[model samples]
Target: MTIESSRAEISRFRSAAVAGTLTFDPDAARRCADLYEEQAEHLAQLRQALENASETEGFGGFVSAQQLQAGFAHKARDAAELLDRYIEAAYRMKEAFLLSAGLYDEADAAAAAALRAVDTRVRG
Candidate 1:
């Protein structure tokens, strides 16, 4: 595929990643994960295709098969890096949700302590 097509695919994957994280619904989150997985696979395929093309036609001035393979390897590495960032973002969002829920626990603890303090004051 052309560079334009590759960029478009990357954009689509990035959008899906963002959408999945922004959504609060469990179903949507699952969809997002699925999309991310699909995107990663596509990226891998694209990288291989580019490597093959470069080998056959001396891709953009690549002098040898080794150079073509290296280019694809770099592309694959970039895709993996992007995937890691997306996963990390998802994890952080989940952590934030848990922390929000924990606030109620903190509130209950504080209330219980206040009650104990009042009881001791009255008894003393």
Candidate 2:
């Protein structure tokens, strides 16, 4: 991936993320799964971007101080990986939310199940 391609992928990912919305009991599984898969792909793209960044070291060496600062591939890669981990956790939260909905037949029971799912997911 070149710098141009990385920018394109990042733009596409941002568009997709912005277009997504969370629904409580409606199409939760499919919606969450779709987003999870997209985020996973985004992670792969980010990795490729980092690889491209590393290969662009020669270009960075001839650039100005500001460009050198901006060319810090390792930092960008670390931050992106960390963000992906958080995104992965959010997908799990969505899954837990759906599980809560499915585990109970009554509204009150669903509330209890939801609480348990959220607590367990958040704490552990």
Candidate 3:
């Protein structure tokens, strides 16, 4: 995706968050975190599998095949790097979800406490 597109999506998400149009559900956030963790693990496994399958041992007799395999290996390494970045992003997303859940829950508790204090003063 383009940088502009990513910025736009981030802006939209921020706007929604600021407007409270998106409700924060701790349970949902936790579920999203779990999903992200799973995705990261899957990507890691996929990257390892790709590396294993890209080995040049089977094509030793053919110089052309070895060259092709070398090219494939290079591309595979690039792909593995990209996958590693994606896995890192997934973990970051998971952390963000968990942190937001904790922050929002704390805010809610604080608000409830303030309201209860107001209630007691009003009764007095």
Candidate 4:
């Protein structure tokens, strides 16, 4: 798939990740799958581009398949890390919502204390 299409898929995945459902939403799972697919597609395109470039006489010596693969692997690792961050943020949001719902007084107290600490630090 093309970069644009991969980007569109990732956008959809992000939307799904943020959209909640009643039960078994599968949004997170879908997001994970979409992310994986996007990474794979991106790697494939990179590999193809590298291969094409290597076939050019002048540019052939510029890069090797191993180097291209390593670059793709690095990008894929970055993508995975990004996905982990997104998932972590989503879970944190969910946890905060649940905490606020079930322990409003405690959450409020904590927030107030945190604000006071920040204010003191800023003033000091």
CA lDDT of each prediction against the hidden true structure: 0.44, 0.47, 0.61, 0.42
Q: What is the lDDT of residue 90 in candidate 3?
A: 58
lDDT string for model 2 (1-124, tens) is 5434644654454344334532245465446545654664565477557656644445445558547656576576565555444444434433443443342233233235334434533553
Residue by residue across 1-124, what tens digits does model 3's lDDT show?
9434643654564355546565457888778767877887798798788778666477676889889889998888777766665665555555555545564553344334334433433542
- Per residue, candidate 4 scores C-alpha lDDT tens digits across 35-87 of 54455445445545544544433323455855665666566555544433333
Worst 10 residues of 4 by lDDT: 91-100
On a 0 to 100 scale, what is the lDDT of residue 89 in model 3? 52
True lDDT of residue 11, candidate 1: 52
Residue 77 of model 4: what lDDT? Answer: 50
The TM-scores of all predictions, comma-separated, are: 0.35, 0.38, 0.62, 0.34
- What are the clash counts of all predictions, listed in order? 0, 0, 0, 0
Ranking by lDDT: 3, 2, 1, 4
lDDT of 1 by residue, 18-117 (tens): 4454233444544544454455445445545644454444356546766876777676555544433333333333333322333334324433433443
Model 2, residue pairs in steric clash: none
Roughly what TM-score does model 4 have, to 2 decimal places?
0.34
Model 4's alpha-carbon lDDT is 0.42
Which stretches in model 3 have alpha-carbon errors above 4 Å?
A: 2-23, 103-124
